[model samples]
Target: MSDTRTPLSRARGLGSAKEGVHHWWMQRVTAIALIPLVVWFAISLVMLSGADYAVARAWIGSPLVMVLLTLTIVVGLYHGQLGLQVVWEDYTDGALRVFMIVFTKFIAVLFGLGAVLAIMRIGFGG
Candidate 1:
């Protein structure tokens, strides 16, 4: 077998990761998903604005609302991670870039888990 890649590509090694398109696509998809979820979240918050703590708790405890809120949290965190990754990649270099990318990912996951736990606690009336 013979390699067909251009000399410049072979030398530079700046070619595709094959995962870039997938990541890009997922970022866009999550962004689109967030539009409706954010709108629903905003409206839900507005409707609950004047309500008491119990009323807000009850609203969050509803199965449908709980699921939507969880979805919103998960998707929003994922989307934010993707965006931050791009920013870090573009603006940083070497160790700092690697550190920032890892740190961002870690923080995003931690926050997402915290959000999930909080939602579950409220939903289960704990």
Candidate 2:
């Protein structure tokens, strides 16, 4: 306890373990951003139900809808990965933890791409 470590050393706490606050804050920030978007999404989906393919296409075809949808998907996916990263850190066993984190990141990127591509197709292919 009397080692007299530098302030940087004490603040780091994790030493070389890694800085986790950014990941934590990004997760929360994205979540906060998504709450309002998701409410709008829910309403849009409900009202768009029973719409034919063309109608559905037109609904998502507008530039405003397209951009918002893309943003929502991207943020949601990133946040999802961050939240899962924390969960994996807390629950995963030793050797497999790194593997799980990488895999989760890959999956998140894939999902985000899928959502963006889907929206783009709907917006432009019509």
Candidate 3:
């Protein structure tokens, strides 16, 4: 077998882990998905700004609105998790990096579920 890597490359120990492309693609996909969802959400919020509680509740109670809201929450959480994971991976290492990533994921999931539940409660008139 022939060694193709240079001395610095071997010394630095930085090599492709074969997962970077997948991670990059996932980040991009989530970002693209968030664009329209966030735009819709922002516009909806603006339109609902002056509405009363009943009107707001009715808007959220709509099936389409509920579905879109759920999607927005879920995707936004996932996207945030991915970005935070990358930051942790880049800025920290060893146990702290692992812990940060795990903690970030936990918080994201927790908050995401909580938000969705709240949305569901309002949407279903619970």
Model 3: per-residue Cα lDDT over 22-104, one tens digit each: 77788899999999999999999899999998898899889999999999999999999999998999999999999999999
Candidate scoring better on lDDT of 2 and 3 = 3
lDDT by residue (tens digit), candidate 1, 37-113: 99999998899989998898888888998899999999999999999999999999999999999999999999999
Ranking by TM-score: 2, 1, 3
- Report how far off residue 120 is in candidate 3 (Å): 1.8
- lDDT for model 3 comes to 0.91
Winner on TM-score (1 vs 3): 1
Question: In candidate 1, residue 96 scores what lDDT?
Answer: 100
Q: Please list all clashing residue pairs in model 3, or write none if there are none.
A: none
In order of appearance, the predictions have TM-scores of 0.80, 0.81, 0.76
lDDT tens digits, residues 1-126, model 2?
687768988777654557646776787799899999899888988999889978888878889999888888898889888888888999997878999999999999988898788888887783
Model 1 stretches with alpha carbons more than 4 Å out: 1-3, 6-18, 49-52
* Predictions: Cα RMSD each: 4.7, 2.5, 5.5
